[model samples]
Target: MQVDALTLSKFQGAAEPNERLPMKVLGQDDFLQLLVEQMRNQDPLAPVQDTEFIAQMAQFTSLEQSRQMSDDMKLLRAQASFQQGVDLLNKEVTVQVGEEEPPITGTATELEMVDGEPKLLINGVFYALQDVIHVKAMDGSNESQSKE
Candidate 1:
């Protein structure tokens, strides 16, 4: 019988009770089931030894552990990349807000950093991530004049 990827994944160990129908993760049960099935269908004179079974199980365990570790590492890397992107955007001089290209006008009032994102307080109005465009630091002279 030919088992496709989807079919193989859903099949719990043939040795495992029906109550334990679905295997949570690829594990020893699956390996044992495959081994049992192979022996059951093998020639009457030919049998797989215990040593071979142990070796195969060891190899499967190592492979499964490595796969799980690699998946975790990938998730960490993705999170780090996302954080770096956010940092770069926070330090940017300009930001694209949606498809609406509002003309770059008005002076920035208060510089607000919300959720690690820098948003401009423009024309005494607060802007969100999708509202602001050009953002620059106010010169000391401009700040002084504005204060006056």
Candidate 2:
């Protein structure tokens, strides 16, 4: 498309214009603003084509839907993480606290919420999900080994 010099100048070289992905990668609001500006400052002798305007509106709708889908996926991910934490309750696991501290092994007795983080309680001690290095089934293996 052969864009006029005046429209290009307004989009790019405007006074106090932002050099960010202002027009090239437009969001919903940016696309709407561009459409509004095109309508407002169009040449009187040659107005914007009807088909062109409709196409721009369709593009805006697609952009809005994609943004909505992104938000929904984020929400779903958070919910899944929380559910995984809840499932750890009463399950025996090996937890590696840090470099200085030794790994702790015990059944996950409960889930504790400490400052928005999910903590697993093992014998009155609190540990985050990352601390859980491995999960082992409590099938009397440790008890039988202790008898040796």
Q: TM-score: which candidate is best?
A: 2
Model 1: lDDT to the true structure: 0.56
Q: Which candidate's lDDT is highest?
A: 2
**lDDT of each structure?**
0.56, 0.74
Tens-place lDDT digits, model 1, residues 72-113: 997786566445334323232343455666444455445555
Reference-based lDDT, residue 36, model 1: 84
Lowest lDDT sum, 10 consecutive residues, model 1, at 139-148
CA lDDT, candidate 1, residue 30: 72
Query: Over the full model, what C-alpha lDDT does candidate 2 score relative to the true structure?
Result: 0.74
In terms of lDDT, the poorest run of 10 residues in model 2 is 139-148
- RMSD (CA, Å), candidate 1 to true, equals 13.1
Off by over 4 Å in 1: 1-32, 43-45, 93-148
**Candidate 1 TM-score, C-alpha based:** 0.40
